[model samples]
Target chain A: MILKSLIFINGFALFIGFLILFLDKVISRYGTVTITLNSEKEFKAEGGKSLLRVLFENKYFIPSACGGKGTCGYCKLVVSEGGGEALPTESLVLTPKEIRQGYRMSCQLKVRSDMAIYIPPEYLEIKEYTGEIVSTELVTSDIREIKIKLVEPESISFKPGQYVQIRFDVDGDFDYRAYSVASHPDTQGEIEINVKLIPEGLGSTYLHALRPGDTVYFSGPYGDFFLNTDSKRKIVCCAGGVGLAPLKAIARYWLTHASNREIEFYFGSRTTKDLYDHSMFEEMAGKSPNFKYFPALSDEDPEWDGERGFIHTIIDRHLEGGYKAEAYLCGPPIMIDAVTDVLLSKGVPQERILYDKF
Target chain B: MNLALILFASIITSNIALTYFLGMCPFVSISKNIRVASGMGIAVTIVMTVTASANWLILNKVLIPMGLQYLQFLVFIITIATLVQIIEIFLDRFSPALYHAFGIFLPLITVNCAILGVSLFAMLRVYTFWQTVAFAFGSGIGWFLAIIAIGGLRKKLMFADPPENFGAAGITAILAGIMALAFIGFTGIASL
Candidate 1:
C-alpha cells in the first residue's frame, strides 16, 4: 500500500507537470514574440511576460516606483500597435487623453505577440550608475544625509531636483527605492540624498543601514521636478521634513548661478530638533546678500520665539502686502494643501505654484 | 446533505469567508474595489470548484487505498497549483479576454485556503462523488456571495468616514468582522 501510494503521488505530480508543459507547447504557445522599441531597438521575448518585466530584463530604464505593481503608474509606455486593447485596470491609472494616445501602464499590460512600444527619449537617457557611499551623516534626529561617488561611467548630469532609483541587495534579488538628488547639479562624480527613517520603510531602512564604502547601484535622472529657469519672479520655497531634498538642489543651483535676489526659503518643522541642517541654510544666507531663510516652528517651543504657527500661517501674516512670487512647496499633504491655499489667496497664480507631495 | 440545504447553508450560515474566514487575504485586500472584488469572487468560485473536485479525486483514488491520507495537504496543494497553471494557459490561448480579466487572480487562487479547506471538508464528510461535487459547487458559490457582499459594503465604505484607528487596511478588517457577525444571524435559520 505504501509503495503504491508513493508512486501514486509522485506519478500524479509528474503527469500534471507534463500536462502543463504539453499544453504550453501546443495551444498556449505564441512562439517567442519580437519586441520593437522606439523604432530603433529590437528584442525577442516570451509571449506571456508583462511588458514592464520584458523592458526591465532588456536593460531599458523605465522608472517604476512601485516595482511593476500597477499602483504607481510610473512605468507608462505608448504601444503603437500589436498590444491589445486597454485593460480595465490600465484605465484606472491612465487618463482619457493618455488612453486615446495609446498610453498604458507597462506593468499591467502583457506582451502577447509582436508589439511596438515607445519609450520616451528622456527615459532612454536614464542609465544605471554604480557608486560608493563616500559620506553619511545624521543631519537631524531622524534624517540621514549621504553622498555617493560614482565608480564606473564616472559622472552623471541630471537637472537639479530630478531623482534616481537606487537599487541594493547585490547577493540576492534587488530592491529599488527612489531618492531625489540633493547635491549641486554641476558636481562631477558625486551625488547626495537625504533620507528620513520612517517607522518601518524597507527603502529607508536599507538606505539608513548603509555605511561608507558600501557599493550602490542606481538609475537616473527621473522626475519632472526641476527648476524652471525662465521664470523671473520671486521664488517662494517651502519645505517640510525630508521634502527639502529637491528644493535644496534647486536652491543650490539658483543661488550659485542665477542673478536674481528674490529667493525666499521657508523651512517648516514642529520643533527645533526636527529641523534638519538648520545652520546650513544660515551659512548659505551669509554667503548671499539677498537670500532669506525662514524656519517656522508649528507646535509650542520654549526655545523658538520666531514664527510660532504653521508655515502657511506665517505666509498669510507676512503676505499682507502685495508681492508677485512663484511658489515651490514640498511637504506632507496637509502642509501642501494649506500652503497652496495661502499662496493662491495671496495672488500666486495656480500654474506658478508648483509642489511635490511627500 | 440535501442539495438545496447545502446550497443555502454554504452561502449564508457556513460561508467560506464569513464563517471560516478562510480567504481573508484576498477578501480584505481585494474587497476595496467592487469591480475587482466581483471579478475576484467569480474567478475564485471557478477555481475552487475545479480544485476541490480534482483534490477529491486525488483523495479517493490516490490517498485512501494507499493509506497515504497523511499527505492530503501536499497533494491538495499540488493539485491546486497544477490546475491553476493549466487553467491560466488554457484561458490564455482560447479566451484571451477572460484570461486578462481573471489571469492575475488565478495565481492568487492557488494560495487561497478556502479552496483547500472546501476540499478537506468534502473528504472529512466521506462524501460520494456527486455529493462532493455538490459540496464544492456550493462552497464556491458561498465564497462568491460572501466576498461580493463584503465588496458591496466596502464600495459604500469608500465614501463613509472611517474611524481614527481605521487606516485603509484596518477599515477592511473591521468590515470583515462586522460581516462575519452579520452572517451569524443565518446560523439559527439553517443547521448545516
Candidate 2:
C-alpha cells in the first residue's frame, strides 16, 4: 500500500511538470518580436524579454553592472519607436533630460513588437570572454593577484591601462565587478588582475574562494586610461595597495617599447609587509635608466630603510622645478584626492592627469 | 450584515492601502503620475474582480469538495499568477491600447499582496459568491481612490519647500498617515 501511494505521488508530479511545460510553450507562441538594433542591424528575438538581454544575445554588448536587474542604471539605450511605455523601474533612474531624449533602461523595456533602438558607438566593440583561472596568489591579506588563461578569442588586443569586468557564480547570484587588467598588452592567451577585497563584497567573496582551474566569465577590454601617445611629457604613475593593477600594465607597456620620455613609479603601502612584487619593479628600473621605482612606506619599523612618509608628501619633496609630467593616479578616494591636489599644485596639467577610483 | 455593508466597509472603512497596506509597492511606484496610476488602478480592479469570483468558485467547487481547504493560500497565489498571465495575453491580443497602458504593470500585479489579501479575507469570513465579488470590486476601487489622491498630493508637493530630511519618503509617509486618519472618519457611517 505504501509503494502504491509513492507511485501515485510520482505520477502526479510528472503530470504537473508536463502541464506547466505545455502551458509555457503555448503562452510563448502568442508573442512575436522583431528588434532592429542601431537601425543598421536587425534580429528576431523572443518576445517579452528585456531589450538588454536580447541585445546581449545578439552580440550587441551594452555594459550592465546589475545583470539586467535595472538597479545599476548603466544599460541605457535610445528606443526610436515601437517599444512600449517606460516602466516604473526605468522612470526611477532616468533623468528628465534623458527621458526627453528617448533614453530608456534597456533591461526594463520589453520588446513586445518590432522596435528600433540606437546603441552607442563605443559599446559596439565590447566582447564577452570565457577564461580559466591560471593562478590566484595573495599579494596582501586583503588583495589577490588572479591570472586567467583566455580560452576563446586566443588573445585580447587592449590598451595598456584598460579594465575588464569579472563575473563569478555564488549562491545563485551572478555578480560582476570591474578590475584593471594587470597583464601586459603583448601577452597572448593569458591575462592578470589584482583584486582588493572590499568587506562583504559579493564578487570579492566569490573570488577569494576561487582556486586555480576554475572557469570564470569575464568581458571586455573597457576604459581608456592608457598613456597618451601624442604627448611626450614625463610620466608619473602613483598607486596605493592593489591600485597597482593598471599602473603595472602601463609599466609593462613602457618597459617593452622604450620611449625617450622619463617615467617615475610611486608605489605606496602601509608597511613593508603590505608590499608585493617589489623585484618586478626593480628589474624594470634596472632595464631602463629613465624609469624609477619609489616604494613609499607610511609607517616604519626599527629596521626600516628606503622612503618613508605619506606618498603624496614624498612626491612633493622629490618632484622638482615645475616639471611638465602627465600624472596617473589610482588608489583609494582619499589617497587619490590628496595625490591629485599635490600633483596639480606642482604644475601638472589637469587635462594630462588620468586616474580611476573605486 | 449584508453585501452592501461589506462593500461599503471594504471600500471606505478598511481600505487595503490606507488600513492594511497590502499593495504599497505599486501604489508608491506607479503613483508618481496621475494618468499611469489611474490606468494601473483600472487594470488591478478588473483583475481583482475576475480573480475573486473565479477563486470563490474554485474554493467552493474543487477544494471544499475534496477536503483541501488547508491548501487555499498556495492555490490562490498560483491561480492569481496564472490568471494574470492569461489575462495579460488576452489583453495584448484583443485590446492593444489598454494592454500598452497596463502591460508593464501587469507583471507587478501578479505578486501584489492586496489581491491575495482580499481572497484570503473572503475565505476567512466565509463570504458568499456575490459578497466576494462586491468586496473585491470595492477594495480595488478603494485602492484606486487612495493612490490617485496621493498621486495628486505628491504632484503639488513637488513645488513645496519640504524639509531636508522630509524630502521624498519621509513626507510621503506623513501624508499617508494623515490620509489614514481621515479615512477613519468613515467608520461611523450609517449601515447599508
Candidate 3:
C-alpha cells in the first residue's frame, strides 16, 4: 500500500506539472510584434513583455525611477499607435495634458501588438558606460564624492550640469539612482559625483559604501539643467550643501569657457564645517576680474569670520536692480524657492531663472 | 440528497463565513469599501466553486478507489494552487481587462482558507459530485453577501467616533460577531 501511494503521488505531481507547462506554453503565445521607435527605428519583439522591458532588451533604456512599478512617473513615452489606453495606475501618474498628447507609462503598458512610440532625441543620445572607481572622498559629514574612470568607452562628453543614472543591486532587485556629475566638463576619462547619505535610503547607502577599484554601471548625460552658454547675461549661481555639485561644474565651465562674462556664486551651509571647495572658488574669484564668490554660514562658528547669514540674504544684498542676470539655482526646495523670489524681486525675469531642486 | 435544500442551507443557515468563520483574513482586511470588497468576493466565489468541485472529483474518483484518502489534504491544496495559476494564465491571454481587474487578487486566492475549507468540508460530509458543487457555490454566494453587508456598514461606521482601543481590526471583529449572531436567526430555514 505504501509503495502504491508513493508512485501515485509522484505520478500525479508529474502529470500536473506537465499540464501546467502545456497551458503556459499555449496561452502566453502571441507570436512576434513590431516596435517602431521615433518613426525611424524598428524591431520585432515577443508579445508577452511590457514596453519598458522590450525597450530595455533592445538597448534603449527609458529611465524608470520606481523600477517599472509605475509609481515614479519617470518612464513615460509617447505611444502614438497600438499601445492601448493608459491604465488606472498610469493615469494616476500622468497629467491630463500628457494623456491627451498620447503619453503612457511604458512599464505599465504591455506590448501585445504592433506599437509606435516617440522617444526624446536626447534619450537616444544617452549611452551606457562601464567604469572603475578611482577614488572616494568624504567631502562633508554626510556627503561622499566618488570619481570613476571610464573603462569601456575611452571617454565621455557631456554638459557640465547633467546627471547620470547608476544601476546597482540592492536586496536582489536592481535599483537605478541619478546623481549629477560634479567634475569639470572638460575632464577626460573620469567623472565625479557627490552623494549625500540619506537615512535608510537605498541609493545613498549603496553609493556611500563604495570603495576605490569597484566597478560600476551607469548611463548618461540626462537633464536640461546645463549652462545656457548662448545667454550673454550675468550668471548668478546659488547652492546649498551638496547641491553645490552641478553648480561647481558650471563654475568650472565658466572659468574656462566664459571668463569674460560676469558671474557671482552664493553658497550656503549650516556651519563652517559643512562648507567645502571654498578655497577653490575664492581663488577663482581672486584670479578672474568678472567672477565673485560669497560663502555664507547660517549657524554660529566662533572660529570663522566669513559672510554670516543665509545665502538668500547675501544674494539679495549684492543683486543689483538694473542688471540682466540669468540665474542657476541648485539646492533644497526651500532654498531654491527663496532665492528665486529674491532674484525675481531684484528685476530678474522669471524665464531667465532655472533651478534643480533636491 | 436534495440539491436545492443543500444550496439553501449552505447559503443562509449554514453560511461558511458567518456560521463557521473559516476565512477571516480577507474578510476583515478587505471589507473596507463596497467596490473592492465586491471584486474580492466575486474572485473568491469563482475560485471556491471551481476548486471545491475539482477536489470532490479527486476525493471520490481517485483517493477512495485507491484507499489513499490520507493524502487528500496535500492533493487538494496542489490542485487548487495549480488551477488558480492556469486560470490566471488563461485570463491574461484572452481577457486582459479581466486579468487587470483581478490583478493581485488572483494570486492571493490561492492561499484563501475559504477555498480550502469548501473542499475539506465537502470531503468530510461525503458529498457526491453535484452536491459538492451546490454546497461550494452556495457557500461562495453566502460569503459574498456577508462581506458586502459589512462593507456597507463600515462605510457608514467611518463617520461615527469610537473608543481609542477599538481600532479598525477590533471594530471589524465586533461587527463580524454581530453579523454572525444575526445569521443565527436563519438556522431553521433549511438543512443538508
| lDDT scores of the candidates, listed in order | 0.83, 0.81, 0.88
Residue range A1-358, candidate 2, lDDT tens digits: 5564455445544654675567666654536677787788887887767787778667777777556678767788899898656666778899888888899999888666789999888888888888999999998888899999998877887887788888776677455677888888899678999977878888887887789999888888777677775677788999998889889988888887645678999999988777877889999888888898899999865555989988999899887544579988888879999999998899887888888775
Candidate 2 C-alpha lDDT tens digits along B1-192: 588888888888888889888898888778889999999898788889888888899899877885666667767877787678778767755565687678578878889999998888888889889999999999999899999999999899978878988867778778887998888778788322
**DockQ scores for all predicted structures:** 0.46, 0.21, 0.47
Residue pairs that clash (backbone atoms under 3 angstroms), model 3: none
Worst 10 residues of 3 chain B by lDDT: B183-192
Can you write out model 1's per-residue Cα lDDT over B64-171, one digit (the tens) per residue? Answer: 877888989989999899889988888887777888887478798989889889898888888777777777787788777877887888778768888868887888
Q: Which candidate achieves the best DockQ against the true structure?
A: 3
Q: List the residue pairs that clash in candidate 1.
A: none
Whose TM-score is greatest here? 3
- Taking every candidate in turn, the Cα RMSD to the unseen true structure, in Å, is 7.6, 6.3, 5.7
After superposition, which runs of candidate 1 have C-alpha atoms over 4 Å from their true positions? A1-32, A46-49, A287-289, A320-323, B1-45, B66-96, B103-192
The better candidate by lDDT, 1 or 3, is 3
lDDT of 3: 0.88
**What's the CA RMSD of model 2 in angstroms?**
6.3
